[model samples]
Target: MENRQENNLVIKVHESDNVAIVIQAGGLPAGSQLGEGTTLAVPIPQGHKVALTAIAEGEPIVRYGEVIGTALAGIARGDHVNETNVRLPEAPALENMPLATRPAPSAEPLDGYTFEGFRNSDGSVGTKNVLGITTSVQCVAGTTDYVVRRIKNELLPNYPNVDDVVALNHTYGCGVAINAPAAIVPIRTLQNIALNPNFGGEVMVIGLGCEKLQPSTLVSDQPVKIYENSQAADPDANILSLQDESFMGFEEMVDGIMAMAKGHLEKLDRRRRETCPASELIVGMQCGGSDAFSGVTANPAVGFATDLIVRAGGSVMFSEVTEVRDAVHLLTPRAADEQVGQALLQQMQWYDRYLEQGQADRSANPSPGNKRGGLSNVVEKALGSIIKSGNSPIADVIGPGERIRKRGLTFAATPASDFICGTLQLAAGMNLQVFTTGRGTPYGLSMVPVIKVSTNTALSQRWHDIIDLDAGRIATGDASIADVGWELFHMILDIASGRKQAAADRLGLHNDLVLFNPAPVT
Candidate 1:
């Protein structure tokens, strides 16, 4: 397990699968033997699949026990199977899928799992003690950043109890069809993001007075209400409009923002970390830069850890609509009830229509990097991606930016793009996040602590300083899935308790929030 010289070999995901990914570094040369009778007929790149048996053209190239694609050409024994040899397949039909067909999973309460976290005025708990400066529109982003930096330099030391101050800047909030039917997604996303549990329920808004998304209308509350006239009724919501006559100069605007941020920081400074039950953790699971090993190594390990959180009465969220679209049949039956199953379908249908309007389909997924990493198409990617939820019964289907009120595994509808997905999950109240990558990425969210898990040892060693955990040991037989899962479980508690900072947080590597505005930009 220490080195691949003794263990480099092909990895077959399932017994019935005909294609296996090459695990040997730099790939194996032509005529190399991979088990008996499976001789390489051509070069196979690391993490790319090779044909385990001869197959006729148009035959199914199976991986993960499901059809990834059909062989576009006759693939001989040990031939490297890639996009050139495999043709994408149509997605699984969505209608009439089975509902609640599986038995309910055990609802046993796990013991002794707790973390030191900030207790908020609301019932919610926070993993960080930071003042969040949210914007109603993007116009005030520059002013907001100046204010946030100043607060961090001159003001943050005075309020040592507060972690840091951040400007929640984004590309939306103006010059869009805000009245369109599809506009609700981005609007609610902005609203709910301000309400993220990490913010300690301290809502602040900076806006340009003439923006389409009015400051008064962006208040986020529970029960999923949409303002009919885009107006807010919460008088207590803090809003600093830069264009207000109260600010006649640039200095005044910065002063006004700094003044408001200080108030929030003072309140945040008083908050202290206390022992809280693990149930307070609302965790979001996602993947990017995926290679074939993603499903085999990292995702399955995350899945095992997901169940652990659920047993501890914590909530785990798995999203990315297109990534899960092809696996609805496998997932629908695991729903907690018929309604949950229906909710899954409704979200799927909405995405289908959304993509159709653009004349593209799920096939648009599995980007160039994915194919290079041996994912032939979306179907193959879906099979690997869906394993992140483990076997926990889905307790709820959260719409974009909606709040979660229950504890268990939940599905939050979002596109598969890494940044957009993270934004939507943050809006859904994810105080912590676990991200698995195979080809490797430095993706992280600004508002949450993201734990990066690598699928293979190569990536873990290469990006040693950045990746937080390595599930790659399972692939090399150095550790079992359950072993790595428990390791990650404990790591989550450490991160949540502020005993450690994830690499993303340490490097300040964060992407600006990208709202999923399906509405047309006017």
Candidate 2:
């Protein structure tokens, strides 16, 4: 079990793994000599692999203590373990197992867990205090944007605590049937935006007079002010004036909202390190721009972290139900109840029907980039993707834009589109998101802080600004998955308390919204 360093190359992560990862590059030949007792099994590159022992075909290749795939050919000691000689085993169908048979995790509370959030009038907490400028349709998007642009450049400069002035503009809202199913979709989407935890104080809705959607119809008694385009000679000026008055009069009316925000930041400055119970945390597991290493490195590490969070009584949610495809059996036995399992099955069937009607299969996922990254099949991609959910009981299933009510582990129904799913997840009330990627993406929601994790060291270093954590070390054998998972957990808390800004936030990449278009009915 002794690892000796040679020629600037070192093996750091020594799990009970049959392989060791090369951590640095050196001009070592295939038969290069190492320490007195060691020799090169193969020429290894930094962030690649080396064999610890001879592997036979069909033998399981273990990394991060999970069976990633099996060896395809006989491999000698110190040989590089990669795709040429490795292939994933066919996953077995899920059995009908009872939830009670699964191991029960101990009840533990997250220690000293608290976020400096705005406590809303209705008791919900908000991470950001936004003053939203909303419009009902694309026709009014220009007006809405004009109002927000004026506020951002002119008014918000005075209000230092207001995070940003945002406009909820969309392409849809007109040209679609305004009947039961059609209208309900956008209506619910708008309502979710209005009630999102990001907005604390107030919102101003501006609607074009003749649009299918109306501002008056959407406005409720929820601390919102409305102004129709028909009401003013200059709507932008009126809105600006209203904003000025609102910020001015809020000192007396809102009483302590600003002061509370300021005090919360001060208290948040004290960062005493403490191990909180895992159950107090809720993790949103997600992947985007995935590659082969995704399942092996980042996604599995995220899964291990998900397990830690779940075992500690915290919850985790992973979606993209359509991508589950043939892997539904893997999750069914873990369902909290028969109803939950049935609900998942029903959703899968519905998605299949929808896809078939379009003469397409949802399995036509894994974009061109994914294919180039060494993933060949949707099942292979999904088998790896599901690792992010960790090993937990599937306590519940949630529909699109639905609030996460049940506590334990749940599966949310979100499409494979990252922006749409991410936005919907945020709207579903996830306080934060843990997004893993290999190719990299700059996407974030308005309120929820997305922590971007890289699956490989090269991407992590190349996109350092965007990637918050690097599980690539797992691939290079520099760190264990569990250790990386621990690091990720703390990073979550750091972002939650405003100590860090995910790359998406720093880039101001928050143009995400729920898409509500449906297939046209005959």
Candidate 3:
């Protein structure tokens, strides 16, 4: 993992890696020496790979000691290695992957790490005390949105303790195959989001009575009992139907929702933050706008923080099905047991089928932005993306939209899309999110505070207000992964305890929640 930066800075991850990524701010010009004997045959962009030795035609292009692709043509030393000259190889076969061969590292337990969080009766903790209004169908979204604005502007000020009001609006619940097997993904996602600990167990539903999926069906009848001290009212009692004959006009409908929201707000306002152990933390890990530096810097730094979280008895989840697909073999061996290993394979196979159903395949990834950032294809991108999980034994696996009950690192299967992954993580019970980015994005969630880490100092300098931490120091030799990891851990406690606010939260930058609905829409 050492990089020589005195001359032309280039990162060589492993001794066997035939290529090292260029780290110069403006890239190195042709004939520039890279400290190594090799000279640049051509100008290389920052983050792009530079060949260290001549690669014969059809030879494997290696990074992280794995074949990311094959050379399409002969290459000279220091020649740029990119999608143009690289041909993607077949994804590793899902069968016969090593299962649970690596043992979990033994480390002294991390103690006395605590944060101020709202305690819920369900024994789960909440970082934010919010009122979440769930909608049974998109038909009620506009009305719910209007009422939520009213709740925030009008009633929210009255109840000083409630953090915020969010309309759990989505494009599901109606005009789809409600009974389809795949429908459970989005349906359970919405149901579990309402149960997100941040909502403080006060659930309200707004619906149009004529929809195929009824409001009562959206929330379970025994939802209150799931929590130990839950004082939630009946799901039916809190549901407000816009088309219920009692409402004469739109104003009446808005008033009904407003009144319903007030009761929830009052209960939520009464709740106060209390000191909770770090073990209560459920952190979700994700990466977007990734470049080659992601695996080298930010993601690895996050991986270190992830291990710290798990060492403290806290839970951490790393998701993105396609991102992990190519690197699944590396993960399967780290599973806690054979069953967990199989579960990892199951998710990969399911997603493989999903892509095929859409007439697509794994190569669909490495978005244009990704390629511009030095990722030649999905394999290269995946090798960089999975670094955030750290080296913990994956204790469990959960499919899309399923709630995670096991602690430690769990692989929550989800789409590679930023919004979908965040939404599913919310349903999986994440109270905070640490997102790493190299290419840069404004992605954020209204439900949880997002702590953004920039993969490079350049992006950090340009987007100082948005990025919470700069891991690029690792590339420049200013900091080690442990330095940034410990820093991020302390920062998480501060942000989760309400002592600090994330930049995204401060700017009110939130992306809309997008549900993963694989079922056919009619």
Clashes of 2: 8
Error of 1 at 264 (Å): 1.0
The lDDT of each candidate is 0.85, 0.63, 0.89
What's the number of clashes in each of the models?
0, 8, 0
**Poorest lDDT segment (10 consecutive residues) of candidate 3:** 221-230
Point out where model 3 deviates above 4 Å. Answer: 1-8, 221-236
Candidate 1's displacement at residue 96, Å, is 2.0
Maximum-TM-score candidate: 3
Model 3 over residues 187-302: C-alpha lDDT tens digits?
A: 89988898898988887888888987777666683342111112443323467777777667898778767766777787888899999999999999999999999998999899
lDDT of 2 by residue, 342-420 (tens): 7777767666766778797754776877755555456556766887877777888887666676666778877788877
Error of 2 at 269 (Å): 19
By TM-score rank, best first, the candidates go 3, 1, 2
Query: If scored against the real structure, what TM-score would every candidate get?
Result: 0.95, 0.73, 0.96
User: Per-residue lDDT for 42-130 in model 1, tens only?
Assistant: 88888888888898999998887778889998988878898888898877788879999999776577888999998887889889877
Q: Could you tell me which 10 consecutive residues in candidate 1 have the lowest summed lDDT?
A: 224-233
Better of 1 and 2 by TM-score: 1
